[model samples]
Target: MEDSRDPQFASLSVGDSAVAVLVDRATDDADVIHDIELMTCSEYSHLCLGMPSDDTGDLAMYTNNKEMHAEDRLALWPAFHRDRLAADGRRFADEGYDFVVQHQVGSRFVDYMNHVGESTFGTPMPESLSVVEKFANTATTSHYLVLHQALMERRIPRGSKILMVPAASGVVTGFLSATVSSLEV
Candidate 1:
């Protein structure tokens, strides 16, 4: 898993689109990685779902449970609003990165990465949306598709730096940051 990035790409980010998170997993000794933050448990109400039946005998209502599961997914959104990612992206900009890599799950996430990139550099930046556009979503491997697209398009400039923000779930909510170079990846 420690292989270098794929192309002249800047970075790669992965994970679920929900659950706001703040994490910096970049290391100076290594190439920067493109990553993201996501959580398996979204709504606080998601925490309320599928509990082991209480000995008190409360039968789980199928419809109610489903509704709760669906409606309560944004419970963690407050933490990762556009402003937060904007702020973090700015911090990345300040760190001297030239571009960013992100997950391409769909248009919303694509637009989101654009928003964050725009807010970070105070200008338009290249997006990694082509992968999702062409291949739809590949779940955890979506970032790789993005990197592959970046390589094919030659969008990344050699020696440029990139940022990543990835997501994860399964009861865990966090992010990993890494700096990657286009020349190497």
Candidate 2:
């Protein structure tokens, strides 16, 4: 797999069963990403959701057109399954684990979600296929959430650690947002 990381400045770590991980940090080189020592596999878990960067931006902006108000933005969000997305975030929390959504900012999902909201609603919006392109980056993020929940339901202990590698920063942030919302102080 060439480790999927650049060879020149990459690092490595061998964990249980000889699991090898290569980390590509903000730096131009790879750093050895090791197990989060403070946490255990049973205490924490991660979901790596993909964040699509194609249409979410334009759609969100188009949905929240300059003329739209907060109420309007809110309206469009639910229209394009924004509630469903939020619900998905809730789902991760219900299972007692945090998520790590990774997606690039400036991309569709991030761009709009970051500002106004998702469109895909209204009387005559874009087709489902076009809307889906915006979510391409989110598949991995959602997958991680689902998997994390499943593991916790099976009694994965709190503080256990799970690794979500090579996903967009947005995905990781989404997961964290979901987790924070679900936990009680």
The model with the greatest lDDT is 1
Q: What clash count goes with each model?
A: 25, 39
Worst 10 residues of 1 by lDDT: 4-13
Could you give candidate 1's per-residue lDDT for residues 1-185 as a string of tens digits?
Answer: 12322221111233233332234654454555544555555443333333323342533311132232232332233245334556665443355555555544465665665565466446565434346667765556655556556757787665555554443323333344445452333
Off by over 4 Å in 2: 1-75, 78-106, 118-140, 143-185
- Which portions of model 1 show Cα errors greater than 4 Å? 1-90, 116-129, 168-177, 182-185
Q: Model 1 Cα displacement at 4 (Å)? A: 35
TM-score of each: 0.46, 0.18
